[model samples]
Target: MSYVTKEGLGKLRKELEQLEQIERPKITQQIAEARDKGDLSENAEYDAAKEAQGMLEMRIAKLKDIISNSKVIDQSQLDTSKVAILCSVKIKNKANGQELKYTLVPDTETDLKANKISVHTPIAKGLLGKEVGETAQITLPNGNQIDFEILEISLE
Candidate 1:
């Protein structure tokens, strides 16, 4: 099951709608138009259209499954005492005293550019359930370990 915020769920729904309503018909028309050119053995346009349609259908199916299994989390009732999904955490590196902030979100809502890290990532996994003033040691994918001290936690 996937856990997502209301905003994330809305975004998913919008994307699904676009694929089903707009894209589906567009592809169907392309397939029909390609088929009109007749020879089944040597039609490149028909083959390309069919391939694109298959990919789009697969993507639509995956989105539908995600939307059906997802649950929206209520941000207002979240506990800010410890780090958890949807919590914005501020941490300082133990070695260099460098500070960085990240928001722990579900896999579907992760946006690296926006400082949102997926809960399944190494850093987020290590920080989970940690409170302010606590230190967490996280192992990177490259076999390096780093210690970070939790400076603050908030709902933003």
Candidate 2:
């Protein structure tokens, strides 16, 4: 099962609608135009159009699967007592003494530029269920270890 916010679910729904209503028709028209130009065996345009259509259909199907299996969590009912999805956490690095803040979010809603990290990530997984003032040892992809102390957790 996939967990997502209401906003993320809405975004997926909008993308699916666009793929079905707008992009599908556009690709069909392109295919028709290409087919009218020449024979099927020698037509490069027709082959490219068909390939693009296949990729688009695959993307649409994946989006539909994600949406169908998703469970939207209510942000208002989220508790700030521990680290979880949609919870903003403040942590202090034990080795470097640097502080960092990140909002734990679903995979589909994760954006590094926005300081949103996926809950399935290593650091996020290590921080989950840890309360304030507790230290968590996280293993990085580079085989390095980092110790962090949870300073705060807020849903706002």
The per-model lDDT (C-alpha) reads: 0.96, 0.94
What lDDT score is found at residue 53 in candidate 2? 100
Residue 38, candidate 2: C-alpha displacement in angstroms: 0.8
Clashes of 2: 0
Q: Looking at model 1, report the run of 10 residues with the lowest lDDT sum.
A: 40-49
lDDT of 2 by residue, 1-156 (tens): 899999899999999999999999999999999999978999999999999999999999999999999999999888788888899999999999999999999999999998999998999998999899999899999989999999999984
Q: What would the TM-scores of all predictions be?
A: 0.97, 0.96
Candidate 2 lDDT at 51 equals 97
**Candidate 2 has which clashing residue pairs, if any?**
none
> Distance from true position, residue 108, model 2, in Å?
1.0
Q: What does candidate 1 score on TM?
A: 0.97
lDDT, residue 79, model 1: 98
Q: For all candidates, what are the clash counts?
A: 0, 0
- Scored by lDDT, the top model is 1
* Per-residue lDDT of candidate 1, residues 1-156 (tens digit): 889999999999999999999999999999999999999579999999999999999999999999999999999889999999999999999999999999999999999999999999999999999999999999999999999999999988
